[model samples]
Target chain A: MTTSPTERNGWSGDGALTDMAASVPKAARKTSRLAGPASTAEQWPEFEAVAQPQLQGAAVRRLAGRRSNNGVGSSNSSSSANIGNNPSKRRWPRVVLIVAAALVVVALLLVAFAACSISRGESSFEGLMANAVIETGANAVSYDEGKTVYYNGHTYVLNEDMVSVLVIGIDRKESAAEDKPVQADAVIVVALDKKTGQATAISIPRDSMVEIGRYADGGYAGVETAQLCLSYGYGDGYETSCEYTTTAVSRTLYNMPINYYFTMDQAGIGPMNDAIGGVTLTPLQTIPKTQIVEGQETTLLGTDAYNYLRWRDKTVLTSSLDRQDRQIQYVKAFAKKTLGAAKSDPGLALSLYNQVSSYSITNMGMDEFSYLASVVMGGNITGLDVISLPGEMVQGEKYAEFYLDKTAVYETILDVYYTQVD
Target chain B: MTSEQPPTTSNPDPKVPVVRKYRRTIAALTVLLVVLLLSASGGIGWLIWEHNQREKAAQELAETPIPTVEQPVASTPDTPEVALPDNPIDFASIQQTSPDVYAWIYIPGTPINYPVVQHPNDDFFYIDHNPERNYAFEGSIFTEMANSLDFSDPITVIYGHNMHDETMFSTLHYFEDADFFAENDEMIIYTPGHILTYRIISAYQYDNRHILNSYDFSNPEVLADYQEYVRNPDSLLVNTRDVPLTSTDKIVQLSTCMTVQNWNRYLVNGVLIDDHLTN
Candidate 1:
């Protein structure tokens, strides 16, 4: 209530009084726009000091008229008559209004509460829909907002766009033969980045000493370090075996989440090769020219495709490591040719999937299948990046064990972690 | 109420009685306003209570325990070789009260524990019918007539209302967060002999189309093309797996209405990765 010098002097000087009068009207106009009881009373004292000498009655009537016009009127005539004249009048109507307003505000708040509760009852999906439906019209919502495990004290949230797949080439002729026992000859951890359209395969040689998980019932039985490929033998040739194999590979890489697993027996290869139309591989090693010889880009179809992938001559293809490189070449070629054809025809990639699905047992359903197809069909068949898990070829009793180089394995995973593809 | 009457035979200006009559009218109007305000508050309170009841019912049903039967082969066996739980859901007991209850769908991370229904002839039968078979605004989760009741289709498109209250398939929107979609890729559908597991591949807002009626699944070209289409979905803001899809795959689509630009349908898709049959 501290008065400015100009407002204080207005009681005496004529010009000052005129200036005060002008400001008072502006104040009164402002008072009408604001709510609450104290505002109207605050404006009256200045008005009374200047005008009460002659214009008291007119001011009172004007006050009543404006109050009614603003819709904050009361039916009490006594309060209306006394409004501009009395600075401290005990009015019951004001009390009534305050109570009514408080009630209204409470009701409104409750109504809002009920609305939120109702929306909370809707599923998160419906909320998104309702938000879009309602907010889109207003154009107001800002949308901001995994097998994942913590390794070495750092948490790596499993990337939704990233997936690790265990591709097991069961040592059987053709793909559908899972009834009898078979060994997983070729074990490769294929990692794909759908975002950058890049694929990397880290081949796990059969002899790496790693913990292979076994499942007793639906539970993880235990982990045993043996020849990396023997984990496949722990399960009785059904869903159990696939589960165990997936775990073995996942654990080998510090428990990376394996999103899906696919077991392809020998039977699946020919159809798969044909499914992708045909795959052409550049020779990583020469088979010493026997017609379709060494250092040549081999376009493989049917049985030849399988042979090129599984070939290992001590004099030519040489070792299991050599065979793995051929497999990687086959995969990269298959992806490039299939994905390339998909750009023009669109159905070629899916057709390939359908053609080969019968021989393979995988954990990928339609949605997973769709996303895979979608990423591949993304055009631009650049080049495939393949790396074999670095290891030492140690001489074992019967066969040699490719002792995994721990440092190299970690570096490869980090490469996948930080590497970005265009 | 004030009883102000007019003058019978006034010898004066007649303004006095008129004033009294106006005061009476004002009094009557004030009384009417109070009643209206009270009634409106009461109505809103009732709506809140009703919504809570529906949620309570849904919770009760989900928590109702698969009611000990001859035990559908123990769920978690001591060893991997032991038989996994595979028994048909007791549809007979569920249908005794509501014939609509058929299969049940459960997702661990999201709020998606509910009974699913199938109408043999009508696609929209359960769009307005509750699990209790009552005509409620929040409908039950239902698949269209275009899909086989056995869920044998390569793509079984299921539908449910997008209620403002999270009653039906509305929770499917939980997949909007790519992490939720990735961490919880498994979708379990309990059927007669098999417990089918589907990995969620893509979750995004899609155009409103009668999927089963629109696409000819029998055509390898159509099937193949659709697989690719879902891969590069129109608006995949959240998530997608980099898995390769072939036409030989089996997919089940969970479809619901989305209110967005042009108000279309939002779809969460899953592919059948593995199936464990029961004894």
Candidate 2:
């Protein structure tokens, strides 16, 4: 009561002002006219000059509007009218902009993370009937996503989801340059059904006479009937070579689409053998150039793996046919070991892929490979059926040629790549 | 129970200083924001600059002048074989660039035409170092200390980086293709007085274990086993020729790293096919 009117309202008074405000040349007094007991009109002019630099345009204007209406001290009516123009009015837009910017940053990070997770230089192969299905016949019945046909009294549908990989064993020796065309010594088409967890491998002998596209000077010349293995020699020796072999095989097997190709040269046998921690098998035949006795169980390791897969008596014309039988046996054992190892250590397949990548070429992406590996690792696959093409080997000109049984090829393709509609 | 009421929303102290109260905190926050922004930008900028510099250096090194082979004089049935002229590569001039240059290797159908250098002191000095003795990720083609300079070793393992730009030994992958491996076979190494030609027998991926360190080449049994492995590598990705390899044959192995597996190496195995004297 003893203090002046200016001092009572905390203007130019040390007792009323905080230490922070007292430190400034001219302090900004925060006044809520509606909430406070009373703030005089005389105090506002000084407040405007000192706080104008810090206050937003809207806040400053609101304060200025209040000063004009204020005439009497403790004017409740004037303060009540200005309450709608509080600091929160300006804060809404700023909070919205901040939230929008935060969301944009989060979206960008998510996109970048997804991009990084995808494997580089790997592409998923699109199946031929990925979207469109072939018309079977008037007696066609649709089953799920597949088209069905009445085949020999059984309603069969093309299992479009079956993942087929063509496995080729090349027969080019280290000293193999003089040979005119490289041969696919052992050719096997491995197909797996993810839904049923069933796997089937069909081994086609190298000498099977099939239609092969001919190329001279890297350009397609014409299609000629040649031994099935010679199809691999027409391309650039990597992807193109693999493609030619796949196409030849597809044509040979009722034109069923093959999703992938895996080729192993004679060199990859030993490391691949050790990768599965050595495959133990009783030799079906006495393998030449090695001490492996027929009907004796031997754990093939290092160079022994090479000899077991590659040994053939060149003098015998049907030596290749004999060799194919041995290869089929080896493959069955190898697959069993690989699937078993993968079950215990899920990373075994990818690690093996990486190890053999130098010695092998594959079109499989990491995602597709992992998915296939996971299916195998899930312990869902209990049995693998390997079938050799029913054919007769006849010595043709200089090499042995195997003429495939057409009816058998047709039925095998249906059995391996098709599902029962019922 | 004794209770105290919370402060009401109305009548907040009107005398409180708004701007002066948070000035120190505001200044500190602004400084932290600026520092974070600058360092993030600086790190990204440095990475981009380094990548650009590496590319530029690779381009400059690839333009180095290399010697081309002189076509041999045609031989009639009466003559033994085509008579090759004197060595075209000036060993004297190449030695001037670096005395460590002992031989130049050229593979037909591949860009692997470069001088082979062996550091007198450090075995890996040329692995990440260019021929000009500058730091380069695309290092010069080199051989280790275990082999002889005369190309007389039973097995010589030459090493190079599989550069992303497909320089150095990257083109060696062309042999992985069955067709390319069949069509192309010869790899020539030209020393000061001798032109040694090797017939490529096999090209495939092998484990990363040091070949020289793992095996004793002097042992005939080991050489036989190795030759057999080379002839019949169990890898699915192999290209082999019909040429035969024996303990009497000298072989050269061109080695490079695989893209995915650091623990594996791609090897192009070759056996000595011919040796011609050059002035």
| lDDT string, candidate 2, B222-264, tens digits | 7887888788774424668877777799989998755432224
TM-score (chain A only) of candidate 2: 0.68
Q: Tens digit of lDDT per residue, candidate 1, span B1-279?
A: 111232333213433333344345445535744664676667667677667767765676457554222544544556556664535566667788878677777766555667788766554556666767776556677876556766777788776655444446666766766556767787878765667788888877653334554456887887887888676563423367766788778888887654321124567888889877764
Report clashes for each candidate as comma-separated counts.
26, 23
- TM-score of candidate 2 relative to the true fold: 0.44
Tens digits of per-residue lDDT for model 2, A134-193? 222243221122234455778877675677778888756642776566767789998877
The DockQ of each candidate is 0.02, 0.01
Candidate 2, residue A170: how far the Cα is off, in Å = 1.6
User: Which candidate achieves the best lDDT against the true structure?
Assistant: 2
Candidate 1 Cα misplacement greater than 4 A, ranges:
A1-422, B1-20, B61-88, B120-122, B161-167, B232-234, B244-248, B257-262
